[model samples]
Target: MPIAFSANLGFLFTEYALPDAVRAASRAGFKAVELHWPYATPAADLRAALNETGLPVLGLNTVRGDLDKGEFGLAALPGRETAARAAIDEAIAYARAIGAQNVHVMAGRAEGETAERTFADNLAYACTAADAHGIGILIEPLNARDVPGYFLTDIAHAARIIDRVGAPNLRIMADCYHMQIVGGDLLTRLTHHLPKIGHIQFAAVPDRTEPDHGEIDFSWLLKALADAGYDRPFGAEYKPCGRTEDGLGWLKAF
Candidate 1:
């Protein structure tokens, strides 16, 4: 089977507004799209755009408060259970409204046993809420260099969290850009953790640009994913150096 791709609207189609980005993605040949935060545009409007373009939303992220103030995520912060649960609930509602398949629950900056316990508990709650809607809850390990002090930095740690939560709907959102920066063994780690992964995203490592410029060889990696029976959309979650459409030469064949 051919590997599918989803445009990450949060990074791509910046020249256009969120609602128009969905149409832009379809024009650019993507069958699906994902968003970092689509709350600014009402779900009804986004649904209209999706219906117009026939592009399904693959996944979206839970609210990460105050990007300018450097709040990356909230789920793992101790003493913030109320805020975390609220964020999860909001994500679930938005995802359900838009018919998204997965929601990535961000873990925020946190540490120690207390933080871990809080994160696990919050994930369990998120899973329970999302399961009813048939939406998968994903946890991703951000590379420390990019998002210093992110709670979940190791994929193995993330896997353990999923196991501890015991939520059948909980899975990992493995981004190759972050994983390559954290460690170089992309294929090995991906293969070993395949069973726990719900979604996969990619970009050029070091620069976070189009996949073609990277040393990771996404052409081979994507084929590997298909050969390994990964029947899910590969998310193009990167900043385009120029116009997003100009940088899509790498994906022309797909």
Candidate 2:
């Protein structure tokens, strides 16, 4: 089958509320949808929206508290084990409620051995909580340029954490936008890390716009992913230059 596409509701459908975004994505031809955070709207409402539209929610992120306050993620912060686990549990419950297949565990601003240990412990807890439901736990590497002081900014480091946790349900949420910014060897990294990847996302490099207008050619990248046997949906997680629907020519072409 041809590769599927998932709309990133958080970024694309900003004009509408979460439930409306779900319907919009489905109407626009996305096979699935992913959310950055869908907590503001009740889970039942979101689930109803999904059911109404026949669109599956592929994944969602663990709560990233107060971005304006410089708080991004919580999984790796030292001395915050209780809070991290709480956040993870909350995400797992929400994922279960909405039938989401994966949850991206965000690692906050932290460093050194302490951060590593905390991150691993938190992930193990998350994996254990999500395993019974068959939900995958994902860890993503944020680009330092866009998110300064993010604990997990290197894909290799993320792989190490996944190995250390040793949880079958734990995997990487490889966002091509961040990967291209922090580590430019896209194809090689994607090929090498295929075993650990749970989900894939993309946006234009440098500008965070539509995938087709990037320095990185998504057509080539998507073809490469197909060649490498990646059957999962590729997420469109970019800020549109105009109306979200107006900038979907690439999706139409694909």
Candidate 3:
């Protein structure tokens, strides 16, 4: 069977408005679309775009707290519980309006026991809020190189946190590009965490571009995912090397 794919609007169509990006992804033959922080766009506009394109939204990220200060996320930041929970609330509300399936709760730069406790607490709060709306909560383990000092940098750590929280709706957002850089044991991790995986995404390793130029053998990787029983559409979360639509040969190649 052919694998279905979801376009990541943040990376794929930066030149276009968020709503227009939705239409562009549909035109490119994507089964669905995801987003980064899309708070600037009115939820109604985006929902109309999705309705027009007939594409369901996969997920979107919580806002990166104070980007000017280099805060990528707030969940793991020890002293920002209020901001973290508020961000979670906002993401949950926005996601609900757009009919998204998941929310990626980012764990910002931090460490030590305090950070761990804060992250778990925030995730618990997020999961509880999302569960009511029938939306899932996702935590992605960003790599050290690209996301230096990030709290959730290892899958094992993320899984442990999920287990600690013990929320049925909580799961991992496995982005293969980050995982490959973190470590090369993708298949083993995927199998081990299959029960906990909320979503899957891919891009070129070393350089976050279209999968066609990557070190990863996406054809093999995709087959492995399918063989492992993950039937949901995989997320195409990669920066384009050129015009987003022009760089879509890999969609057919895959």
Candidate 4:
């Protein structure tokens, strides 16, 4: 069976507005689409695009607090509950507006027991809020190189957090690009953590480019996912080297 692919609009289509990007993904044969921080776009316009194109939003990320100050996220920071919860609330509300299925609650840079507690508490709140709207929460383990000092950097760590929160709707967003950089042995890690994985995303290893030219053998990687029974669409999250459409040979190559 052909793989079901979802374009990560945040990285894939830089040339168009979010709504137009959704339309482009649909025209390019993507089964679904995901997003980064799309708060700037009017939810109505994005929703209208979704309705017109008939594409489901797989997931979206909460805002990265104070980007100018290098704040990647706010969830795991101590003494920032108000800001953190507000971000979560905003993301859930936005996700609802655009009919997104999941919200990736980003855990910014931090450490120690206090940070862990903060993250868990915030996640619990997010999970409860999202559950009411039939949405799930996803936590991803980002690599240290790109997001140094990030609280969530290990899959097992993320799983432990999920277990701690014990929210039925909370799960992990397994990004192969970050995982490959932080931890090799993709198949084993993915299979080991398959039960708790809510979504799987991919790009080339070494460079966050289209998967077709990466050091990672995406053909084998995707096959491994299919063999493991991951029926959900695999998210194509990567930076296009040129115009987004020109870099889409990977879509056809798959």
Candidate 5:
């Protein structure tokens, strides 16, 4: 099967218009597109764009509660329980509205006084709401280099949490960039954790640019995914080195 690909619209920006970005993605043969945060564009406008272009939104990153003030994740902190719950609810509502199937849950810092039990309780609650809306929560682990002190920085740790949560609707959003930065044998890891992964994103390891430009052999990696029977979309969540179309020419042959 030809793997379905989705463009992350946020990176396609060039001080140009949003519709132009959508057009570029469609012209490049992307059947689906995802926005990092749809907050700037009215939900009605986003819906209309999808209608006009006939593209489904693969997923959207959840709202962040002012990271400048040091807020990170809702699922792992006690003080932000109320805010975290609200963010999850907001994400679920938006996903249902935009016909998106998944929401990326930002894993915040694990520091300070909050008990591990408290964080687990909140995550369960958030997962329950997501399950009701027919949306899956994608918990992503950031590499320690990019995000220090963040909980769920390791894939193995994330898997352990998913096992603890044990909800069908909650799963890992594996990013090739972070995994490679963390220095792992990705093919072997993917084979071991296939069942827990709900989504996948790709980019060159250190630069976070398009796939073919990186050290990772994307053709082989994508083939590995196909061999593993991964049915979901492989999210193109990378910064375009130049024009989005030029960056994506490699996919034509894939």
Candidate 6:
């Protein structure tokens, strides 16, 4: 399976609007693009942008509590159960119109209690709801350095939760940057857990910049994905080093 790039509109349009981001991604030769939060922008506008650009949406996260107030995660275990459910429901409805099959559910930070058990329970609940919508739910782990005290900071732990949830619709959304920050052998882990992976997002390790700026050899990683039978679009979820278009010079070779 040859790898196809999917731009994350969140990064490209961080300084611009969704419409311009879609156009930029299409111009960069990306076949698909994803957003961070659909509710922040109107669904009609997003739909129109996708229509104009002919780019499919790969995935999006469920709505978080507050984007500005530092609340940016969905599955926060037992304490935030009510808010998490509401957000997941909202994201499912959004996905219906945006044509997305997977939604990243952020795991809440552990509160120094029985964190693991609470996380497992929440994951099961989320997976059940996602299965009802005929969509998959992805558990994305942030690095401990960036998100201190976060309960699901380890992909291996996330994998365990998915196994405990025991639902085919629940899986891990493997972000390469976080994986590297957490000090894991990505190739080995990705190969070992390929069956439980729902989607893939990428950023250059160290700088969190475009692939060309980082030391990560994405070509080899992509080839590994191909050999491992991953036939989905690889999400280009990197921060632009400069102008978004200036960072696309390497895609032709990819």
- Count clashing residue pairs per candidate: 0, 0, 0, 0, 1, 1
Candidate 5 C-alpha lDDT tens digits along 60-145: 77676777877566667767778877887888888888788888877677754453555566668778888887888788888888
TM-score of each: 0.97, 0.97, 0.98, 0.98, 0.92, 0.91
Distance from true location, Cα of 99 in model 4, Å: 0.5
- Between 5 and 6, whose lDDT is larger? 6
lDDT of candidate 4 over 6-26, digit per residue (tens) = 999999887999999999999
Which ranges of candidate 6 are over 4 A from the true structure? Answer: 66-70, 111-113
Candidate 3 global CA lDDT score: 0.93
Computed on alpha carbons, the lDDT of every model, listed in order, comes to: 0.91, 0.90, 0.93, 0.93, 0.77, 0.78
In terms of lDDT, which candidate is strongest? 4
**Residue-level error in angstroms, candidate 6, position 195:** 0.4
Model 6 clash pairs are: 76-108
| Model 3 residue 32 CA deviation in Å | 0.5
- Answer with 3 or 6, whichever has the higher TM-score: 3
Candidate 5 regions with alpha-carbon error over 4 angstroms = 13-20, 112-115
Q: Per-prediction RMSD in angstroms?
A: 1.1, 1.1, 0.8, 0.8, 2.0, 2.0
Tens-digit per-residue lDDT, 103-147, candidate 3:
999999999999999999999999999999999999999999998
Off by over 4 Å in 1: 66-69
Tens-place lDDT per residue, model 6, 127-209, is 78778878788888889887876777778877878877788888888888899889668888887888988778888888888
Kindly indicate the candidate among 2 and 4 with the higher TM-score: 4
